[model samples]
Structure formats: structure tokens, C-alpha cells
Target: MIQAFYLPNVAQIKKRYENNVQTLLKYPFLFRKDFPDFDSLSVQYFPFDDNGYIPFYKNENRFGSYINVNDPVIDRYFFKNLDKPILASDVYSQYQLEYLNDNVRKSEWVGQENHIYLHYTNWCNFCNFLSCLNFKQLLPDKKIVFLFEEEISRYPIDFKKEFGIDYSQYQVKPIGIREVNRLIWHTQLAAHNGGDFFNEIFYDHPNLLVFKSVMFKNIKEIVKNLRRQWKQRGKLSSRLETELARLRHPTDKDFLVALFLNNACACCDNFRFKNSKLQPYSEQYSERKKRKKRSTQKRNDGISR
Candidate 1:
């Protein structure tokens, strides 16, 4: 059975996201209808953060943003720990089970719902994808459907090539947030890579299985490592604040550190830090275009010769 867990403490979270949270809280009251109970579980790359801070947040560009890591040593540290493959059993452990059990007991989902929805963003990594496989294994009898952001349709990863998962098995629809809410009622279990919609969904639906991926245990130490590095850097730049502002909500002294590490390790973007600032993707794209043009010109010259 999928399990529900405690929602993150957003008491001090920013107003930008808090508005959605408030709206979600009023959902059941407004509808005043009997919502079916399903075993709901939310999953992400890392285990869910119990302390209330979500690792992923929206950027000004509305893309998966990464924290700038000026130190090569620290950058390499995150890549080694986060970019590796993870096993299902390693994550679905006693600790997670306990949280799920406790939450499920308090939830309204009385455990009869059978539909499972797997939601992820365009920037999800192999580990996030691995969780979907784990869920299918855990609940084979349920009707499972994968719902991804429309942008995922353009993602270049080959599921079959990398993990032996047939594209046909995905059964995904490129959808938006509205579509997700429309289908949420039918979803007995909901798992998503921590997305912005989490603000509206996490506590709004009780008794359903919903989980937000936080960070993994193996990489927690990076939080300390990055804190020291950033502390030494003195003041944070405006660009970095795009992420740091949201992370500051958690009371942990360097709570933002763990979140920074989370964004730095995202699988989708090849993020780089320059002069202690995060590089924009537009620049990266322009560079790629120039390189392609240069390569094409070289090939034509060689042919003429």
C-alpha cells in the first residue's frame, strides 16, 4: 500500500508560495463532497524533507534552476553522490514507511482507491525515473499512468536505451498543472518530483498518497560543505538569491545549503557557475549554436579540399 507522510512546515515560507498553500487548505471545505480515499505517496530524487523546506523552487525563468558552486571541489562532491543510480529498497526503508504509516492513519484516503498517477517535471533525473519503476513493481495491479509536463515531450533521454524501459510502457501525457488537478481526485497514489505545484497539493489533499522528493541521505553532508563555502564568499549575489530566498524559510542555520546542493545536482540542466554567479541557459544555448555553426563550416571546407 502507498503511504502518506507529514507535510513540510511552511510556517515561515514566502508569501509567493504561501498564497497557494492557503488555497489548497480550503479545498475540501469548498467542495464539501466525499473525496475517495486512496493510498497516496509522493516521491522525488531524494527522500522527503521532514523539516518543511522543499528542495526545488521556481526560478525567474520558470526552469529548473541550480545553485552556483564556485568551488570545483564541492561541485565534484555533489556530482559524485547525486548523479549515481539508486536502488528502490535503499529509499523505501523503515524510516519512510513509518512516516507513510503515520500519515496514512491520519489521512482521509481509507485505502480503496486504485489509480496511481506518476507526475514529474521536464528536468527529472534517472533516479526520479527509477522511482516510477519501483512504484510499478510495488503496485502491479493498479492502473498506473505517467503525467509529465508538456516540455518532457522534447527531452532527449532514451528510456529504453538507458534503463531497458520501453517507451510504450511509459503511457505518459504531456500535461500542465490544470490537467493534474483535474485528475487528482482519481489518483489513489500521487508521486511527483518536487514541483512548484507541491505548494498547492501537499496538504490540500488529505488521506491520499503524495510525496515530495527532498534530498538523499548519502548527500546530506554537502549541506555543511556548501555552507562553509558560501559563508566564506561573504554576501550572496542577486542571481543566487533567486534560490537562496526560498531556501531561507527553514530554520536550520544552513538549511539553504542542502537545497542548494539539490538544485546543483539536477539531471536535466548542465548548470555551471562562473565568477560566483549562475550562468543563464540562454548563454549556453547561444554557445551551442555557435559551436554547431563552426563545426558545419569546418566540415564544408574539408569537403571542398
Candidate 2:
């Protein structure tokens, strides 16, 4: 059996200890042989410097091979020096029965269908605002629960006052990466900016909606689209909504096992799993010359006319 150590980004470990701990517990099965007494393994925390890099663990350690769940650039450094450099997805094919069993208990958090999960970070505040506003207009009855990376105060605007929305209508809470996983597992619907994190974890979720920050060209266009969607479909059905609500809640052991197997077997984009070096683009000056010639000919013809 091949044994590998799981190395998450030290910054993430420091910021979200609880969530990282859960991931450490659940995701170790990605390896063939478990680290000796894996449950009893103690983690040591280190402080990160200005660039979010830990200077201490730059060299190879006693841990034979390793699987990393961090940015590709950061992983690349380890890959260059490490004995065996396997990406996180490389080991995702393995599943442990204990982890699947544990997921069933975790799924208990899945509850009523009335709550809508909204994921936003400081980077994409405008998209978050638009998503919340649109959802409120479309489904006034549904409660909006905003999940953030840090404290709600870090956001630039007060969502209620800025949008003229009531505070009673929504709730804001800061969540860790692991909590986001559990919330996605149980929530009725998740509206987010289509970040890589959401794409990876909630890959199979049915009721996930993504709004692009760059798509906000004009208010009129946004309103027109929102109204069009609302007119076409009045609202989600009670039964269908309830069904989506229940899908996240895995009560039965068989369902949990099946889901775990599906996740393990599912294919992800190969590019996401590896850090491909940037390649230089060949010049297309010939195509540009042809286009310029055509433009000149058209202008001359217009003048002659």
C-alpha cells in the first residue's frame, strides 16, 4: 500500500482550523495506506510570512510521498522537491467506509427547504449583492443566509441599507472552507460567484446558481432578464423544493455509500489537478495583415461609391 501525507495550505489551516480538521479526518482515505495511527497524528502550526508561504517546510520531510490540497503554484514548489508528487484528485479515487458512515451523521444538518445559501467574499461583493437582490425579488418567501470568508463587517456595504432591503429578511455568517462543504451538502439552494471552491465541492448539486461579476453591464439588462425568468417560471414547486431539500440529508447508510462511491469515481478536469507551465503564444501577424488589407479595400470601395 502506498502511504502519503496530506498537506493543506498552512494559511488555510491557521484561518479555519475546525474546517481543516474535518477535511483531514475525512479526506485521508484518498491514500492507499493510512498514516500510522492517523487518528492520533498531531498537527503543528506555523506562521506564514508576507507572501502566504511557509519558509520552514521548503525541503522534503520524512513523510514519504504527499498529496496536497492547495493552490497549484504552492503545490508546484513541493512537487519540484518531494519524493512523490501526487495531486489531490490523484488519490480522490479511494473511499473509506468509516468516512462514508461519518458523512451520514454530518448530513443531519440538512433541514428545511426555506433557507437559501448565499456564498460571497470581499473579492466579489457586487455579484453577491445582485444575486441576493434577484433572489429576493424572485422568491420573497425564502430566507437568505449569507456565508462569508471572514466577518460580515469586512464587506464594503450594509446589504440591507444599500439595497433598501430589510435586515429581518436575511442573515450573515462567516464560514470556513469545511463549513461551506457541509452547508452546500444540506442547503436548499446555493447562489455564488461560481468560484473554483464551489465548483469542486458542489460539482453534483442540482440547485446551484452562479452569477458573474463581469456580466453587470447595465441595470436595465439585469432587470429585464430577471423579470423574464420570473415570468417564465413563477416559483419552484413545493414538492420539488422539498425533494432538493431532502437530497442533501443522507439518512440511510446505503445512500451515503453510493454518494461516496460516486464522488470517488467521478472525473474532474485534468488541468485542474496539475500545474501546467505557461507556454508562449505564436504571433499571428499574417492574419492581422490580411484583415488590414480587407479593411483598406472596403474603405476605398466606399469612397468610390
> RMSD of candidate 2 to the true fold?
24.0
Alpha carbon lDDT of residue 246, candidate 2?
56
Candidate 1: residue 241 lDDT (0-100): 38
Q: Residues 227-269, candidate 1: write the lDDT tens digits.
A: 5564444344443434454553533333443343334323213
Model 1: how far residue 274 lies from native, Å: 23
| lDDT per residue (tens digit) for residues 1-305 in model 2 | 11121254434433344433333334311111122231222323232332222222223333322322222232112123222211121111112111222222111122212222233343232221121111222122223333443433423333345545444332222111122223122322336545656555543332221221223236455444433442233333332223334555433332222222222223321211111111111236335545878999999999999
Model 1 misplaced stretches (Cα beyond 4 Å) = 1-225, 231-237, 245-284, 292-305
Q: Largest lDDT belongs to which candidate?
A: 1
Report every candidate's CA lDDT.
Answer: 0.31, 0.29
Candidate 1 residue-wise lDDT at 5:
25
Task: Quote the lDDT for 197 in model 2.
Answer: 64
